[model samples]
Target chain A: MSLQASRNISRFWEWGRKIICVGRNYADHAKELKNAIPKEPVLFLKPPTAYVREGSPILVPLYTTNLHHEVELGVVIGKGGTAIPQSAAMEHVAGYALCLDMTARDIQDECKSKGLPWTMAKAFNTSCPISEFIPKERIPDPGKVNLWLKVNDQLRQSGCTSQMIFSVPYLISYISDFITLEEGDLILTGTPKGVSAVQQHDELQAGIEDIVTMRFTVDRQDH
Target chain B: MSLQASRNISRFWEWGRKIICVGRNYADHAKELKNAIPKEPVLFLKPPTAYVREGSPILVPLYTTNLHHEVELGVVIGKGGTAIPQSAAMEHVAGYALCLDMTARDIQDECKSKGLPWTMAKAFNTSCPISEFIPKERIPDPGKVNLWLKVNDQLRQSGCTSQMIFSVPYLISYISDFITLEEGDLILTGTPKGVSAVQQHDELQAGIEDIVTMRFTVDRQDH
Candidate 1:
């Protein structure tokens, strides 16, 4: 297979390893879903094939009926490190992107109940939709930006990063302690409240302040 | 970063995406662990950083008191496909490797009880130890091979591929229906009967019918 450049980052990087995601980072979001606030970050993963860029529609997997859109701020790692200190974590970030963590809620719930892995629910193709990246310099304070998402032109989620239970640097430090963070690896900071089911032909838009914006359409998988 | 050859596979392949795994694919193994026989294949994942070779030591994560070794066969994908049929699945096979799915049983049990993702329990660095790849032709009958692991000359896991609940082709087909498979990606067939903990300086030797053999030492994380 030929090497391909990342859709957003201009530095010509490939999807190095995995897309690590944090769950229940925002108090209100966790409360909305009736989940206890986690003492530490809850983590999951999406394979590289889950990546979907603009101009392509997010295909709802045939196995899931309830697919929800979770808007999040994605931290793209520029440098790789292990056991990185929190004070110096920011030095490893290359940029940021607006992302949607499309989830198969029904499948996920079933997996959780049976103590099974969440691969089918979170790691399907087109499960992640991202916007063009904004260099870290552009978003001087990643923890204080406002991010929102709209479904079919109606706002569904609106929140600020300040409400996150864990900060970007803290997550980087926490994750690198166990899983080595490599260049091109992405960290999907957890979503906020107002996550709802999306269906075929629905148009979704999301942005982070004015730094980056993205649009996507949902379609059912025919095969 | 420049592309590097896979640690075990000699065909100059890069770590494509995820390390997809099968759990409870052997009924005897499931019974040994007191887990019910799964109706379908149980899936999980390990990140690329989890890949470790013979000379390297498997570091015991500081958080777990019970770390067990699961010996299994690893299939390397040479072609990428989605929703592929079983008849065509074998064409995608590149080769096979003897692998160890190191598990933190204590942490995994906690995560399972809480209905949480197993990222912490399963995706840590050095969680997977692999032997050099044996080309597909060398193992023409993947379903009829003997795999064994010995810890300090005491036999732990002894099993044969004939006992697998899910044949490799069926697993590849079933997995592709939900998760896309890519070249250089690995599929860890589930382990069999015996599993026990290892400590610092423990020597591990595993092999597949004299076709390929590898040895590793265990060490505790100093930090």
Candidate 2:
């Protein structure tokens, strides 16, 4: 039960740790979804078991009919710390990755209505599809990169990191103040305006500026 | 970054993994809190950093004032499995522990009102305090055992496992169908009827039947 490091930059970093995520960081995305613009970063979580590599297919849970793909920039933490200051937050980053915050939108809505926890909605197996790590040096300014996602070759989401209301360093510092950010932990910066449902067999592709690109196929769970 | 096992039965299990918890499993507790009796187990999470052992103080987060104590029975998973059947679920049991799901009740209510995630309220550092492990053999009838918690020697909660709407085996199987249960992972069965706020310096004691008992002191964060 040891948290193992990614053997190389090309390998998927699948260590068993927490995946902390932000919601509605993009104002346009929040408005489109009819959600109030949060003054602070909206936080949520996905278990480590949600990790699925590039070649693997993202399984649509049997209970969800409206599964959506959210393209986000993922910051991988290299060092662990508590109460990290924004000034030194970037030093703790190991790299960046293109991640799809695959969500069960219908289940999420139901949970929201009932004021229940979103575990079953956000933490199913294969719920997080991550691309290979891009060293922090490659993306000198994570705050200004372009990210986009396409479903079946049609562009569904397109935005730049500049559109984010909360910067990576601020999110890192804020999250660390409460939950200790550990090595191998990941921070999902949040999705942009375009988010829509995907069907089984849909080919989903996402990229972050020309540095990293990944593709995943959606499949229905037979169970 | 390896998930280490407890050094001995007397030590706290400090694996870096998810602490999956059930909410509103006790009918009386749910009624008392004015929450709907969930048709299914309400699930939430706490990060590995939340684990604090006896003798150490549970740090009340700076953001919370009405911090409540929820004493629960924790089931520690021994074997890892997915889509496991209920009949075979017991084989996965490594042991049990007495746990307090320390919660920020005020923050939790606000989060619930806004339909936001409970990470800041539930996953903060020292939000969970657990006693040493209790071997499964020591408590043959997990369903019939009694658990109680006292603050400053004043009994605040007293109930039996029979009050749980969802049994341990069913919860393990149900959760595994969605989130994979790994060795060293823990499932916190929901708390019983009585729950109240605690302030700094409050001495908390909780136990499961006569098998295991633990004491903890609450302290306010210096920050």
Candidate 3:
């Protein structure tokens, strides 16, 4: 009988990352949103403050009518660099985790119409819910994992990381070319197709097969 | 005799209370950019990740054809709430400081044209540079503060916080209506009239009247 080696537990102090989110890194999701599949990684940010802890409840702002759930794979950086080459990019990665980049779809639409920043829509309280770090060594290849999201009892979105237009190393290298990646920073790889609107009191269960499971509840801000 | 304390000894996180940034907050700036003074805060997110140490250098991205500097007063929140009365808003501030909301104007304009997120343009690496936090006990009145910026001994922007269309308190309360602020979150009050472009190797300086001075130099990426 083999005893599992005692899992080494470590404490991370108020860890926050520069969340670089890739928009439409996956071709099918981009097609569903009617956006062109970009030649380069499409990036955005979910402020460090937008990070919601694994156990914290996801807050749904009252100002928007439709809030959506986007299940993504988050890559956390252990090293820092500027203009990193594609070959040396993976070395900068510290670990991976399951993340949900929540959005206020209605507000995002308003921003689209008025030509405004998506800050209000893409970033708000509890907009990004991330799982605990899984060391990169555990996952041999990040580009072939199975990702899924389910609301309550029904599965909503399911896809493989293999579908991404840009692979993991490519995204890490591409983003570094544009912005520096620092320790504790996170890159939220794009979500799969079947993105849908979520309502208050909805239970969101999102995960990557055999990796991490994030369960969260959406509630209106109790101001 | 009391020895003078170095301002460098002090550290501050973003003040909690949703940060509300006005779009084209200045009338003249609005006119120059062909935008109207927003009746409401041109609300956006500069997540906690966007916050930096007082004297950190602001990095310039390679793709930007023009980089602009916009100097403004940063209001820190001491107290927080939702639906806060404008009459009682000022009581929430913890203190104020000088800040630069650096912009890759050309990239931002391109995003505006494509109806995309401004993250690439506004929320990139080291885009925000702020001064050390001065407690409210020190800054009695936020609106009366003077803000300025210089590029290598040449004054580029000079203005007082008094010119703002939306007062500090109103912005704090108004922003709280949508997003909730937490400790160490900063609200960059809009920049005054003069906002111009900078080039590689240019030295930038920003500060409050006789209170703080932040300086840095821009360099081209060595990719």
Candidate 4:
């Protein structure tokens, strides 16, 4: 009813908005997992409680033995809309962020075998750790940017936006047709290859081209 | 940080918080679907975009032909906490609302078999419709209340909360253990048996004993 709130895009997480994720958007990543490259985008979600900034650590859910890190580019919505056209989708972008879509691989494997939802594997607390927002002006061409990830100082994931199966605008338009993207809502574009397990005290570093980089420590949650 | 923004519980939907969901909490329903009774609660999520009220209609996603209606009891969290104990879990409740977890059964079945998330099937626009909020005092025993649903004036689901395999407090405690429950967050505590498909012009009426009732019409989404 009212116009979108005048919240600062830099602090959108504090607004408690939706975190819609796209899975398997990279062909290499799909191959690495021995999965079929999807014809359409694979989608999932992480609740707001999943968000953790630099000050807080990425605590592994107590139930999982394998906690994997997925480096992704997160698009933050500046405008809200339903059935947004691809041509006009970029107009809705406020900016972007470097993010990790942490996954509990063991739990995810069990859930998959049992034909269950991936919530336990994907939506736990500290499942989503992100960098500070990067204004749209910082990246003149989102489609050509580079994204990289490192664990313990060794590069684990390295890819470019050009390798994405679906373009950012295409994803925005497709998702908005049904899910309704709103201001402050986040859409995590799927990860690149080189996803692997992380142990306690491990450090993860990720970046978006030469624009921004973020670091986080991994810790185990006590039962 | 700002004392929960002094948000009115009755208008929690406007706040755009998480809609965490429990699946197969009702044994009879799991039996009907040929799913095993889960040892622990099965969880999923619906984004805030899925919410719709009485005045609006539930539009079946163009991707699904078997849209099913699942009547559920929704718990509105008033306080925020993590790893909440079972005994003190109820103390965090702000109130309750009768809700519908509308699912695109066909798409959900496909997702389940492929080991994918249920976003398209479960989190589309208008997938969640809820009744007016009932203060905590109104429902003295959420575990013993009567919940029922009718389609086109024919009773399709009639089950008491007494049939739920997992009680309200246990669900709250279990969920808050990994996914922190926060102010204004709503949780759909799963549906009972008798889940079935609905079509265009189908009128859905559901209630929580005599405490609250809500209604909505269904129609196919035009592509």
- Top candidate when judged by DockQ against the true structure: 4
Give residue B210's lDDT in candidate 3 (0 to 100): 81
Task: Give the TM-score of each candidate.
Answer: 0.95, 0.95, 0.86, 0.97
Off by over 4 Å in 4: A1-6, B1-3
- Across B42-125, the per-residue lDDT of candidate 3 in tens digits comes to 865544444555445566777888889888787776555656777888776667767778888998888887778777777666
What is the per-residue lDDT of model 4 for residues A44-156, given as tens digits with 9 covering 90 to 100?
99998899999789999889999999999999999999899999999999999888999999999898888899999999999999999999999877788899999999999
**Which ranges in model 1 have alpha carbons more than 4 Å from their true place?**
A1-13, B1-14
DockQ of candidate 2? 0.53
Whole-model Cα lDDT of every candidate shown, in order: 0.89, 0.88, 0.74, 0.91
Specify the highest-TM-score model's number: 4
lDDT of 4 by residue, B1-223 (tens): 2435546789889884899889998999999998899999999999988989989999988888899999999999999999999999999999999999999999988999999888899999999999998899999999989899999999999898888888999999999999999899999998999999999999999998889998999988876
User: lDDT at A35 for candidate 4?
Assistant: 86
Candidate 2 per-residue lDDT, tens place, B134-190, comes to 888898977888999999999999999999999999999999998888877889999
Per-residue lDDT over A1-223 for candidate 1, one digit per residue giving the tens place of the 0 to 100 score: 2243322354312455779999999999999878899999999988888888999999999999999999999999988899999999999999987899999999999988988889889989899898886788999999999999999999999999999999999999999998999888989999999999999999999998878889999999877
Q: Would you list the rank order by TM-score, best first?
A: 4, 1, 2, 3
> Interface Cα RMSD for candidate 4?
3.5
Q: Which residue pairs clash within candidate 3?
A: B13-B184, B14-B184, B14-B185, B15-B184, B15-B185, B16-B182, B17-B181, B78-B94
Q: By the DockQ metric, which is better: model 1 or model 2?
A: 1
Candidate 2: residue pairs that collide: A1-B3, A2-B2, A3-B1
